[model samples]
Target: MISKTTIDRVFETARLEEVIGDFVQLKKSGANFKGLSPFTDERTPSFMVSPVKQIWKDFSSGKGGNVVAFLMEHEHFTYPEAIKYLAKKYNIEVEETERTDEQKQEADERESMYLVSEFAQRHFADMLWNSELGKAIGLTYFKERGFTPETIKKFGLGYCLDQWDGFTNAALDKGYRLSYLEKTGLTIVKPDPNNPNGTRKFDRFKGRVMFPIHSMSGRVLGFGGRILTNDKKAAKYLNSPESDIYHKSKVLYGIFYAKKAIAKEDNCFLVEGYTDVIQLHQRGLENVVSSSGTALTPEQIRLINRLTKNITVLFDGDAAGLRASLRGIDLILEQGMNVKVCTFPEGEDPDSFAKNNELEDIVGYLEGNAKDFIQFKANLLAKEAANDPIKRAETVRDIVNSIAKIPDGIKQEIYIQECAGIMNVSESVLFSTLAQIGKKESTEASKKQRQEQKAFDVVKNDATVEKVDVQYELERKIIEILLLYGNNTEKFEDLVLKESETGELVLEPESVEAKVYEKIYLDLQEDEIELANERFRTIYYKLIEALNQSENFSLSTFLGSLDQEMVSEVSSIMMEEEKYTLHNWERKDIYPKDKKIGVAQLTSETILTLRCFLIKKRMSALQGETREGTQDNRETLEEIMNYIQLNKLLNQKLNRVLS
Candidate 1:
């Protein structure tokens, strides 16, 4: 267990905005930063980070919390992992209690596999730098591709020996379990009963150059190996098989190292080969990664979305290959991501082209040559359709389909006009074609959505229904009032209420708002039923617990413990009531400022709001009618009037106190 002191230090030192800003492209929105939702596919910004509050919220997905919570959600890290991540980020040393041998032995198979994979990554990395064979084989290959020693080390590139059991023997001698080795596909194990100890073993990447694939959090998942020999029987490139922890479709190469640069540049260079990524980063273009030569996938695009939205794909100038690679552009557009394309000079790929040019020249070339997806498509297709009406019409539909993948309606309209001008077709005809494509897409999308919704409804329908209570609206209002105004004690009726004991009346102190909330909470506690809305229920329980624990309750501390949805809901109410305030209460220079409203008045006013709201709700639920425009025959009106009068007094007391 990590010491509580270290955990607290991690939280205090890790700024919410700074940590999240590394992955999310945040823009100023009033008092907070807003960006496209990282957890969902959306064009508008619904993800918000409040620096003043030291928290973040994703309105689209209803996920919100402090810095620790963001890492936990975004990286799929456990609570302890999140704290350790923070400690690493802020340079705080973690203090963990020593575990016993028996406790260590209790590690599950998956965790053990993770440990083995991690150790293998370190071992390979070590060999790359310190071993003679590794330097000659691995470092030589990386340097041949123009990677600096620092760059090679940063990417964890390495090479395993031609000797059959070198890595396997070292791992076993270090006490790593053989079972985990086989499970991770790092060691090839075969059955053998001949020697009684008898399973033959060899390293999976024997005599091959290694490229470490990493998760977003920088943990090594698996390896991609390249062969040095031109053996016809063996494949040129091989990747680790899917295992307990590694999923190829979901992992993007160099994301762990390139995330910060990607966010800083607000663009990612997508290439095909591992060497291409290394060479580009070596040339000082740090914000680049590869698909490991796999075709683009939605999962891969989502990984990029976690850091950026703009992608520039680099392709070789070979026309046939470039045309085949052009299929990925549609996938990028489908995810609502911005895309640009740049093809290198003939006979050169990213690796060779980057090596032959200086950083400034390469950057300038990219800037001048890069074209938007629409223009690139038009240039490629226009030449093929010269004076051929049938091919030209098909080409127009192809472009229109690509345009329809965009999520923003306004952007679609703008692109449509541009495409019309370029194609020399009328805007109306292009718009009509776009509309037809859009209709087809909408129909297909709706069908898929309905299927998903049906599955969700089936599971949801199993639970019993609870209708919203009309009285609860009034209760909610009262709670909001108490939260905002409960601190001002002077606004309440300070007159002591007397109670008769047998024959005489006795005086006692009173707090109207606290008393009201207490009565409501106690009444509900007796029924043992929670509120229907999750946020409201959680807030109610927390307030009740706080009230029960101490004589003084701090609302800010209570609000801090809530999740993002509750905070937004509560903040919306609190802010609506508390936005305007008089400055320098002591210098207001109004008489009787000495008699400032205390906690009682604010609490009472808030409670009064709740009571009135609840009363009105109850009346509505009972289908009761009000005597409109008349003060007589109006018991319900009388209750509402009392609430209004109390609220007016509360505001007056607040102003007077501040003055």
Candidate 2:
């Protein structure tokens, strides 16, 4: 747990623009900042950051929050993780409260696994730098690959000793649980046949160089180990088993280092190994990542898509390897992204090419050699289908199938024309083939949509069957007003309806000045109407308590004391108007009548509206009782008539014309 003082200091020191600008490119727009939405693929800017308000709202996705909330949403960091990230950025010291042994034992399962993985990374790195065997073996291998000491350390390279239980024993001696170690795949356990109820434990990556895999926010999720010895009996490379914290298909090597570069360069270079990424980054081409020798998955492609919409895939000169990886291009096209392909010279991969050439030469080679996916695919397939009509026909069909994956109609037509010219076929023939493929795809898409809609209908029907509390909206509105404008003080006008000597009601408006909180509290107390929603009621009392306690209230300070759910609610309320602000209402010839211009009138009207609603509700209940003949006594009759008169007066004060 983080200490309250440290959390407060962090909230005070971290600027919203400075913290979010690390990941996004924000341009100043008046007093606020605007940028393309990081959460979605948008060409026009919809993400806005307000320094004055210390909150940000992405109008495109409806996500808004304070500095810490943005980190949690953007980086998937837990509350403490987000706080620590900001604290580090602003050079604020983080002081954590000591946890009891019982509290430590009760930690969450996923968090425990992450803790073990983090410890193993440190342990392996220590071995690589400090251990004699690690220096002789792991450090020597990295040096041989032309990896500088700085580069190796940057990637968190490490080594595991060439022993059966070196890592397992170290982790155990440090009081780390074997169960967590095994769960993280850092240790392997096997049953011992020699002794009943006994198990044997060994390190999984013994005798290898370690490459720690990190999430986008730089949390160590897992490790990849390369065996140093030429042992044909063992696999050349080993990876951590899938655990709660690591999903291999969803992670890409070097994303943590490459995300900013990818966003800045507006393109990514896809490679096949960890060293390919490291070597190229060392060459100053920082926008590169690898599939880590696994087949590219849609999840991995989407990860890259978040940073940019263009990808350049680098392949070795081997024709067989190029052909084998050609299918991955269609996956990129399916995601509605532009893809280009580049192949290195014979005997050179990304690592070797970067090592053998200057940075400018390597970059020039890539730019000159990169070809659109369609052109590259067509040229390669044409070579393979030389002088054979049947083979040529199949190549055309294969190219058309890839073209169908493209979602943009204009791009598809352009590619179809390009294919026609390359294949010596007429444009009409290619278009006919494309139409057949499109029809089939449409039918399948319609079927999927129907299934999804049916599931949605089931949920909608279930929700409709439940009774919805109507007063919940009014209660929520009251809370929203309190959170956004509770601390503000302004002049208010109270309209009083009095009985004249002629026995008629007369309206008189009187001017008064007070804080909004004081007016709202007194109004609610006079009416004796409690908030109808439980969540709203809790927030209401909390806001009142905060107002009474603080001499000058700060939103960020108040937010620090709230739980995650309440923080989300408060942020939503505070930023709801920002959407309209982003739309530039002036451009649309629409102007929002300024409610703040008459804060007193707005507050008085809001409270009167609530009172009138409650009065009408009471009148209806009394009418029901009168019809049922359940309460027809003289006193009850008088009470019913009196409520009717009071309802009329409230309606008049609210300027509602009675029918």
Candidate 3:
């Protein structure tokens, strides 16, 4: 377990915006920052971070918390892992013991696989640097590829030995388990009738240079290994098979290194392999990532979409089977992003071009040569259809189909005009083709919608409508006030029961000066009321106790002491209204009342409303008791009547007329 001291140090040193900025691109908005929600697929910025409060809220997914909470949610990290990640980032030394073999064995399957993958990354890097065979073969191969020492080290390139079971034995001797190695696809296990254990293990990437594939947060999930020798039998490159943590389809090769630069540049250069990304980065083009040779996937496109809406895909002109790769551009268009295609000159791919040219030359070439996807597609297809009327017509329709995939109608029309001009086709004919495609797509979409609605229609019709949760809203408001203004001292009006001149019981509002938390605590205690929600009940006393104990309270420090769930709850409550502040409310001449100005009024009304709500609840219980005969009717009736009078008086003080 991490010590409290280290946790405090992490919470203090780790800036929420700086840490979150590594993942999402944040823009300044009204003393806060807003970005696209990483937790959801969104174009508009809904994820908010408040540096003052040291909390973040994703208005789309409704996930909100502090720095650690964001990591836990976004990176899917365990608490300790998140703390360690921050500590490593901020250069803080964590005070914790390393896990023993038994502890490692006891970890859940996924974590164990992670542990093995991380260990394998280190082991392979050590082999690349230290082992003689690794130096002569793996290091030589990387050096020959024109990768510098810094570039190789930056990517954590490594080497695995050729001998079968070489890695497996080394891992076993180091107290690592074979189960994890096999699970991570680092070790292949097969039954062997000649072996003593009736099974044999072989290194999956034997005699290969290793490239560790990482999550965007920099967790080593798997590795890609390239063989050096010209072996006719063995495959050229092998990747760790789909494991619990690594999905090749979803993992970008250089994303861990490229996400920041991509967001900063506001453009993403999409390449086809690992070397292309690294070589480009080495040549000062940092906003580049590779699809790692997998067919482009929507999940991967969404990952890049989270960072930017512009994708420039570089294709190898000299490579075989080039037409198949053009489909990825259509996928990009479907995601509503602007895509451009740049192809290398004959006999040059991204790797070779970067290796040969200077940074300025490369940047100029890319800028000058990057053609819009529609133009690229039309030109490429138009040449193949030369002198064939049917093929030319088909090419026009194909370009139109690609245009139709765009979600934005305006962009589609613009691309349609561009295509018509390029193909020398009439704009009206192109619009007709687009309309036909749109109509067919809309028909199919409506059919799916109706089919899905059929399944939910009966349930929707039979489901009873629920009224607004008044108590929940009230409790939430109370918590919100406590979180935002608990430490604030404000003068409040205290309602005291007194005899009016006519001898009738009435509420007299009088002035009182007390801290906001003190007023809330005393009033709730006077009524002997408790919050109905379990989570709220836990947050209430703990929050009140902390407020009373500290004269100089820090929200970041207080949040550090609570568990993650409570931290998230408190963050959501505290930052709820700031979400609106981050939007364009002021531009429309709309403004919310300043929270500081109405602190006293808000506190008093919440307490009074809570009191009235609790009184009604008790009265309701009494009325139910009278109906069930669970208690004496006379006492129950008298008790209910007293509560009714108190409720009416409290509501009257609140300017509420009770019927």
Model 3 agreement with the true structure over 167-225: per-residue lDDT tens digits: 99999999888888999999999999887678888999999999999999999999999
Ranking by lDDT: 3, 2, 1
TM-score of decoy 2: 0.90
Off by over 4 Å in 1: 105-111, 193-198, 386-389, 421-424, 445-465, 469-496, 499-602, 605-659
Tell me the TM-score of model 1. 0.75
Steric clash pairs (candidate 3):
none
Give the winner by lDDT: 2 or 3.
Answer: 3
**Each prediction's whole-model lDDT (CA):** 0.74, 0.86, 0.90
The C-alpha stretches of model 2 lying farther than 4 A from their native spots are: 16-66, 69-78, 450-469, 548-552, 576-602, 628-632, 653-659
Q: For residues 1-659, what per-residue lDDT tens digits would candidate 1 score against the true structure?
A: 77877776776677778888876788766566777677887766777776765667776786766676787677666566778888898899999998789978876666677789889888888887789988888778877777888888888888877778899999999999888888888999987768776789989888888898988778788899888878888888888889977888878888887889998888999988888888888889989988997888888887787678899998887645666677789889888889999989888888898899999999999999999999898778888899999999988888888888888788788888888988889989989988888788789999999999999999898978888665566456545644544333232443243556774333344544334356455435653545656667777777667666755655535554565456656655543321111122335664332112444444444444444445445555433446343445456666656544444444443343212
Better of 2 and 3 by TM-score: 3
lDDT of 2 by residue, 477-525 (tens): 6776777678888887776778889997666778888888888998799
Please estimate how well model 1 matches the true structure, expressed as its whole-model Cα lDDT: 0.74
